[model samples]
Structures are given as C-alpha cells and as structure tokens.
Target: MKKLVLFLTVALMALPLKVKADEGMWFLMFIERLNHRDMQKMGLQLTAEEIYSINNNSLKDAIVQFDGGCTAEIISKEGLILTNHHCGYDKIAELSTPQDDILTNGFWAKSKAEERAPKNISVRFFVRMDDVTKRILGVTNPNMTEAEREKAIKAEIAKIEQENNEGGKYTVSVRPFFQGNEYYYFVYQDFEDVRLVGTPPNAIGKFGGDTDNWEWPRHTGDFSLFRVYTDKDGNPAPYSPDNIPMSPKHHLPVATSGIKEGDFSMILGYPGRTNRWMPAQGIEQNVSFAYPAWVEGSRLGMDVMKKYMDQNDEVRLNYASKYASVANYWKNRQGMIDALKAHKTVEKKTKEEKDFNKWANKKENKATYGKVIEDINAYYAATNEKSRHDNYLMTILRTSDMGALPYSLGSAFSQYMEASPEQRAEMKPYLVNGINESYATLALPLEQEMLAKQLQLYATKSTGFDIAPYVKEIGSKSNNDFTAYINNAFANSIFASEEKAMAFLENPNADVLNNDELFKLSSDLIRQYNTVPENVKTLQNDYQKSYRLLVDGLRKANPDKKYYPDANSTLRLTYGKVIDLPRGNKVNDAAENWYTTLQGTIAKHKAGDEEFEVPQRLIDLYNNKDFGTYADENGVLHVNFLTDHDITGGNSGSPVLNGKGELIGLAFDGNIEAMAGDVIYDPKLQRTINVDVRYILFIIDKYAGATNLIEEMTLVK
Candidate 1:
C-alpha cells in the first residue's frame, strides 16, 4: 500500500523567523503546536484549548455553516444566529410578498410567534473532527491508477462515515487536504427548525450594493438575525409548532469597547476553495479564458434579469438574490483579472516552480518528484487547447436559465421514467411543484432574448461544439435566423408554458417527452455536452496527480517552513491587527482612521442614487447622535473597519473576534488590492473589510427599534 505523508507539523526553524502575521488560513487542530505562542504574543488572550476542545463546549460550537454557503455565529444562549444579510437574502425574499415586502421595508419580529420559518433553511454545528488519513490510505496502492485510487478512497470514506454516523444521527464527511496529502472527518449536528428574527432594509443591508462591494471605507450594515429551534430535548428536528428555542452549548459575547489601530483581530469560519498552490499555467488559463467568459456571461444574464427586475417589484424581490450572487462574482472575476496582471502572479508562480523543479531534480529526490513540473506543464498545455471554447459553452450552459431549464427538467423526468410506479407517484408532487415554481419566475420575452443571445454567442465563439442539428436545420431553413427558429420552438415547445407542462404531467408519458422539440434540443445539447473531449480528463488527472506530488516535494524541500492547507470549505483560524492602508504611498492619517463612521456615511449620501441612499430613520438617528452605547468616545457610530485577517468567499459571515474572544466585527469582504489573494497573499495591500459589531447593534436597536433582540446578547463594555 502507498501511504500518504502529510506535513502536519512544520518546524519553526524551517521558516524565516521574522515573517508577517497576516498571511495564512491556519487550521485549528495545529494551533497549540504551531500558532498559540505567536498568537499569545500578538495579544490573543484565549488558550488553544479554550478555542478548540472536544471534552467541553468551545468556540467551534458557536459557529455554523449557514445554509451550506456562508458562516454564522451564535450570539445568545437561546441560539440567536448572526450572519451576513446577503446570506439570508434569498430566504427573506421568499418570505416577502407585495403586501409585506420584508426585503424592502425590513423585518423585525416582536416576539417568538411573530418570527417566520422558511423551508429548507438550516444551520450545521461542528461536532468533532478526527484525522482519517491512515484508514483512507490503507485502501490504496501505488500501482493503482488515479481513478482506481479515487474509487478505493471513496469506498473507505463511506465505510468510515457509516461507522461514525451512529445511524444517521450525525452528518459525517471526510475531506481531503493539501491535495489529498491528508484527510480528516468532520461530524456535524444539523438544526432544521431555524427562523428569521430580523433584517435591515436593502438601504442598510446592501447599503453600497455592487459599487462598494470589495472596496474599503464601506458603510454597509451587512448583517441579519436568525434563531435556531429544536425539540424540547435540544435535539435536531424538523420545523414544528411544538419545537422550542435552542440553548446552544456556547455563544460569543459582543464587545462594545471599540477598537484602535493595531488591535489584535481574529476570524474563524469555513472558508471556501483557494488555489494557493496552483501552477502558473492554471493561472494563465483562468485569466485568459475561464474568468473572462464567466464575467461576460454573468453580466449578460444580469442585464436581462435587471430589465425585468427594475420594472416590477415582485420580479425584483424574486431575482434579488440571484442578481447579487451573479454580480458579486462578476466583479470578483474582473478584479482577479486586473490584480493577477498588476501583481505579475503568473511570473511569480513560474519562478517558484523553477526553484521547486531544481530541488526536485536532485539525485535523492529524482525518482519520486523529478517529473512533477514537466507533467503539470504538459497537462495544462494540452487542456488549454480547447479551454476557450469549453469555457464559452460552459458559461452559456450554466448562466442562461432558458438554455438550462429543459435540460434540468429532463434530467428529473428521466429519473421519474426509470422509477417504479409507486416511486413515480411519490415523486410527482415534487416534480410538479418544481416546474410551477420555476415557471413562475420566468418571463417569455426575457427568456427568449436570453436564449437567442447566448446561443449566438456560443455559436460565434465556440468552434468545436455544435448546436442541436434539428435547430440548426430549422435556422438554415429560416435563412440562418436563430431568432425565427427559437421563436417557433418556444411557440411549439411544452416547456414554454406552465399550463401545457401541468397538462402533460396529469398523464406523464415518455413518448410525449421524446416527441417534444424542446426536449429534443435539450437531449441533443446534453449529448454533445457529455461527450468527453479526447485527453481532457486524462490530462486533468495528470495535473491533479502531479500537483499533489509537487505539494509533497515542496514540503520535503522546506521541512522547516510552516505549511497550512489550502482552504477547502473547512473551519480555519487567521489572526492579524487592524491597520489603515497607505493612501498613494502614505497612510491617510487625517484622523480619518482605518474605520468608517456614520458621519462619513452621511457625507456620501446622495438622495436618489440607489447605492448611496440612506434610510430616513438611519438619517434621523445619525443627526440626533442617538446611537446609544454603540458609539465611540467621539459619539460617532462606526460602520466598518479594516483588519488584516485572512479570509475568502465562504467566510462571509464569520465573526471577527477580539483578543478575549469577543465579537467585535463580522468579516464580509476583501479589499480590491488583494483580489488575487486566493492565489497569492499580499500582506501589505491585503485587508479584510468587516462590519463593526457596534454598527449591527445600532441598526438593530436604534434604526429598526428591535431592542428585544439586543437584550438577548451578552455585551461586554
């Protein structure tokens, strides 16, 4: 059997002694060994055991995976969860009607009964984690192919999960780290009966909107409140009127003592993917092909959705989350492109790879690591040949709702066909409900235009792929006008009408689907889409294998250097100090500070500009300085502050803790200057933009007048 050797503990002597404290997303498990002493020296007052412990309730129990994407932390013993407003955006939108419009006017429950319970909303609490490397590696051999090794590892993981889950009472997953160099299993307890507690209006929750999203000196109060409920026994259960408020094992105390420059700050949350070890060629492909297509397609889709959204409040509410989600990445991709070029990231990676290759070519290491660089480079070279066309097709396939719907519906319908009669009957209501909900959000004119535009882009830009032959024939018959062919297809297709779809569902049959033109188009597109390009997966496997070996080689080469696993949606801890960025080669030291206050927010107020509009109630409070105890010594309510804490996408709602483990802020965004931080960390320019916890309290107590919610929290002065 081939064993996996992980560099879990790197010697302090292996690294430069004077390294900056702002770069890594360190794992909690190694804190005692690797980070505790430095952290204590940097002003961390809590012991490593206090932060993470299996024998007792700790900080980890207070954090959760919010709705599978963002992070949230418990702030009260009754399980009041605080997360980014954008994280709860869709749920609030779903609960909103034209009459209620919670998303526009904001919502605050006066009592427990008044709170709204949205379906499919849940929070996952981390129970425990165990290193499962030996068990997984025990199932594989060096002679096995990549696919075989993967299969063996998966089977072993499933076995481990089955044995550890205690009969589905817990959610267990074994995640790979350092490119499969290590494995660890995390067990979680999920709470399904979560309710919406409160949220500020869009004017506050999304105050700066797209323009101020990854920028500094932001004034957005990007926070929302929810509460977890469970059975009387405090066990996970589905939503029921009988359920009671949960008493969490632990909760973070809110700090109102304020912060100064160079104060210690830390964040712990599940950060999503980061490719810190990516080869130069991968960066080149992302910049040249993948990211550009994603940006263009997302922008195009957003434009179509925006036209409808602007004209109708209901449409706006329905697509608000979708638009925000798309717009975030569109801006992020643009920033990444600009930053990668500006920072010369590819050049940096190439130099590092050269050094790695030189080290690998040494006599003792030659057999195991010598070919890694060559293999990775060749794999990327071959895959990059069709990368452009692949990206264009994939973007259209993913972004254009009209183009993707039939295919999505078809996949479900295909499952229904293979199901037994009893099973088919069981699946009917769900399938019908899905079709209805999907159709309700779609508009024919908007969808038609989107379909036509995306197909045209795909046809013109992508060379290797072909559109459906039937559709192409129809277009050729109509003087090569895709518009006519698509219009006719919509007119004749069952998918274009909910009534027709429902009518078909009353007596579902395979022939009806087989004969449907839209279904044919979907089938054809999927057929071509599934056809694996020659050598794509093979080269991809090569790249992954070589990448793993490259990481291993680096570990061997620099045995003394500290090594933290790349972010893979796992809980991580990063600590740093709050600092102001230099403004054009000099720190902006005009008493402007590294934080923003309500005064600055008022200064930027433009009455009708959507991005700059301040709510009237907020204005009133600011004018009167009625921020209560949430204001600084100067009586100004701080809105946002900058910290050097390392964070990425899924850390959106992570609680920013002070030295004493008190919640001071919520990490939401990263400054544009460090947009390439996912690939390369830039200590001087990188900054984590956080919404000050005081601002959250100000909005909840003063602006929204939801003092009932504030009394539940433990506040430290």
Candidate 2:
C-alpha cells in the first residue's frame, strides 16, 4: 500500500503543478484563459481585454522596454516616461562631468525644451504578440538533428516575421519559450529619441546605496523621468531637432489613494530570463562553480575601480555606473548561492526529476520520454566537469571589461587581416571608431592593474594553460612579476594609444599585427579560449533537445494541469498584493513593515555618510511633516513598499498597478531571501520591493520643484 502511494506521487510528476497566484510570470495574451479568474478574485477591476488587447488601446500599450533591459511606463499622452533611477544610471553617469555633475547634484528641466537629449537611449513598445508554436513545430520533428530542426524553425520564423511586419515598420522577434516546446512572435515599435527629463540627486536616487540594496524597509526614491519623441506623424524615428513628443495610444494614471496590506497589484514588463525548469545538476553546477567565479571576478574588478574612483572625481564619474553594475550582480550571485542552498533547491529539483523518471518509465509513456531524464543528467555531468575552467575564463574575459580590450581590438584586427582589400577599406573606419570609443573609457593605469590581477589569479587558479604561452613569456621577461610586463605591454602597444591605433589603421598590414605582442597574445587567447569550450556547446544543444522533449512529454501526460512559459525577455504579467513579509521567515528576523515613510528615511540618516545622508530640504520637509497631498490618511509620507509580484532582473522599473489598472509604484528589486527566484519560485518568502508612487510625487513636486513635469501626469485620487 505504501509503495502504491509512492508510485502515485511519482506518476503525478507528469502532471502540471498548480501555480500560486503570485508565482508565475504569465504571458499577457493568456491572462483570460490562465489567470484572469484568480486575478479578479484578488480584486482586479480591469478585464483581461482591458489589460492586454491588440485591437484597442490597453494597459500593455503604456508599458515600454526601457533601453533594451529594464521596463518603463508611459504616464501621460505627451509620452512622459517613468522608470527606475538605476535604469538611467549609465546615461546619467555618461552625461556627467566634473564641471556639470548632474549625477551628483541632480537635474530637472523646467520645460520640455530644457530637457537633456542623450544620444542612443531608446524605448520600445510592445505592439503585439502571437503564439507561433504550431507554425514553428510543424516544420520539423524529433527525427531531425538539433541543428537541422533549429534551421527549419528559423526559416519558418523568418517567413512569419516577414509576413507580420506590415512593411517593416515594426521590430519583430520570434522567441522560443518552455525550453523550445513553444514559440511566440512579438512586434515592437522602437522610439530612439528618449530624453532625460528629471532625476533626484544620487543621495535620494540611490539612498541606501549597496547597503540597503535588496533589503525590505527601503527608502530609495528610485525613479527617473524621460520623454519619448517621434516624427511629426507620431511614428518612431531617430533623434532629430524637429521631432515632437509622442502621443501614445495609452497611458497609466497615477494612483494617489495609497495601498493597504493586501491590495491587488500587477507588474507588466519584459522579464529577462528565468530557469525554473533547470535540473538539479544545473543548479548545483551554478551554485558550486559558475556563480562563485563570477562573484570573485566582479569583486576584484570593483575593488580596482573603486580605488581609482575614490581618488579622482573624473574617474569616479566614469566608473560609477560600471562599478554599480558589477557590484549589483556580484552580490546578487552570492545571495542566490546562499538562498538556493538554504532552500535545498537542488534536493527539491532532484526529487522532481526522480519522480519524472518514474513517470517516464511507465509502460504507456516509455518510448519518447524514456531517456529524457537520463539524457539531461548525462549532458549536465559532462558539462559540469569543465564548468570551473569555462566559468573562470569567461569571467575574466567577459566580466573584467578593461582586461578584455586586447581580445576585442584583436578580433577587429584579425577580421581586417582576413578581409579582402575592398572589404578592409570599408571596415577600416569602423575599426578606428571602435578603438577611439574604447580609449575614451579605458584608463591605462587601471586597466594594467586589472589585467595583471586577473592574470595572476587565472595562472594560480584555472587549470587550462591556453594563456600560458603569453603568461610564460611575460613572466620570463619580467622575472616572474606581471606588473612590469603589463606596464611595458601597455606603454608600447598601439591599443593603448589613440594616435598609434589610428596611424596603424591608416596603412594597416597583417604583418604588423602578427609582430605586435598584445595582438598576438589576444589572438592566441581568443583561439585557445574558443577551442576549449567547443564541446560544451554541443552538450548544451543536446540538453536543449532533451529538455524540450521532457516538457512536451510532461504536458501530454497530464492534460489536466496548466503551465506558463518561463520568462525570456518577453512581456509578462505577474499579479499579487502589497504585503509585508512575516518576521523570521527570512534569514534576517527584522520586523519589516508593508511600507516605509519619510520618517524612516530621517531615522536612517547619518551626518556625512554617502549612503545615509539626506538632503537638507528633505530633512526640513520631514521635520515639519510637510509632505503635501502626497501623504496618506495618517499624514505620514510613504517612501517604499513591498509586494509579492513575481519579478526578476529585467523587471526593474516595471510598473506596479492597482486593481483599476492605475499605476501605484515601480518594481525595482526582489528581497535577498528570494534571490533564488530565477531557479526556484519561493511563493512564501519572495517579496518585490517598490518605490511608492506617493513618494515619487512628493519628490517630484516638493523636493525637485518639477511641477511642470508633474502637470503632465494623469493622476487619480
């Protein structure tokens, strides 16, 4: 009897698991079928069609993919956009100079014409989405090789995209979902003339700095304003002096009525990626090998940058965004490692896979799904053995941005060498442009130290000796020290000089690159690095095939259950409620409220600490309880709040809307306790941190004195 019960439980693995209301990053198109009933029960007043409609203006129209990464929302018909401050951090840093430090002091345009129009910043609106699963899968079958299957699917997708493009006006993409078991086509219109409208100083924008990052009782006013400009006809266009503000089809109305402990909330945005279906072996490999190296490499880079940034304001402005970008993920990886371990994520995944194996081995389901689990495990095992070397090398080459310059520049030179004379002439200008752009950001003193540091670590730690030839030569010449070698290499290398690189490009010769030490080292490193991981891609391809089969078989085996595809930088909607986490459920047992207020910011203030310092005006406002109409019923000004909305990295700056589809807050970070959300969704422990809309209004209206910007928003009391 006990055996029978256990067998039944294993058989259930083939069935779909019920998703919690706050668990899934659901596709907007399927809300009516999959989630609308649950959402309506949770107090959603808007219909599914109102939330996501292709025929008419809907909430979906207001949301935009900010800068190809974060999310943003249209707040007014005039195309005023709102997103997280960190989403705009890179642009702010790029625009800042010692003489005009907009990042440190903050900037607010009194009128539309005064706004700073930064180059290359763009916002993309989701035009529409359709499931192309049948059209994609109909082209090929399991009998085909993975490469052939992909080729066939790619052809179909190209045909579909071409058909739906409506004369190439829309940017179209066909992305695979559910481990390639499904596919969806998305259309977007990209507006390139996004301009910075207003932002608070770094002190307010990044209030608690890294210290309060991913923490609960947050006070960060992590919001920034931008505007989208279009052609006179309201079509997407490049930045032009004649361009006008876009008149969007839909815009979110700001809600000032405030929220309660369990008020309904929804997050709509392009959630980057999640691996909820990742096998136990995959999680173990990431936690044990890949993530640790990334964390270490990023920390090493940040330390070098910080040392230079602190001493020179110019360097500080230049590297601030870089350091923050690295530091954000460095800590996130550590958090994920800790959370995954504490949650016993691998054990849970192992049990699921074991159950899946049992179900797959059943007589009725034996043929197609029989070896899926075994095949997945085998591929993971083969890749896991080499993960350490792959991760270490990748972290150095990819994460250590400055150290990888030689390889990047060399790749350009190698292409030039291979190109025909005509092709070389056409590409020469691009090479010069790249070198100059790289030089503007590259600080030789910092790069030398960073390169030497990574080299020493790589030599001591990594098992592969692909870079040993260059390291050995440098070591022999410098008497076993890398500093002198790096110094000499940079001092004499054309890559380190704009003039030398340009001069070399003018009358470039393949022999000159062959003789150049840095170029040769870069070429060898690129060659060897490419050669080492050649097998891993094949293993991953096989895994993708097996994984798709697993998902397909599981779905067929259990027609009663429902499933949502994993996030892949596509528009997804996750809805829940604004609520506080219960104390002791997390590693930290601090009593966190559902929301924070201006009073909390005051309490956290320290005299001169960069992280805790409050602006004098803000302090005075708090002291006098002068928060204006943005204050809640209790006369307290809210700063930030917590929610259970399922969000990930790319959900940053996602609009948090009320039951009536009114904008209430901006989704910024997930709690540290739920950092493992990418791998395993912890419904009970996960919390989405957001900056309260009332707080955004207070800062914009009273603090920044940007009443002109405020007047552009549609507000609801």
Query: Mind giving the per-residue lDDT tens digits that candidate 2 earns over 557-611?
Result: 6678778777777899999998888665333222347888788798888989988
Per-residue C-alpha lDDT of model 1 across residues 644-684, encoded as one tens digit per residue: 88788889899999999999999888888889978887888
lDDT winner: 1
User: Model 1 clash pairs?
Assistant: 14-560
TM-score of each: 0.94, 0.94
Q: State the local distance difference test value for candidate 2.
A: 0.81
TM-score of candidate 1 versus the correct structure, residues matched by position? 0.94
Error of 2 at 60 (Å): 0.5
Clashing pairs in 2: none
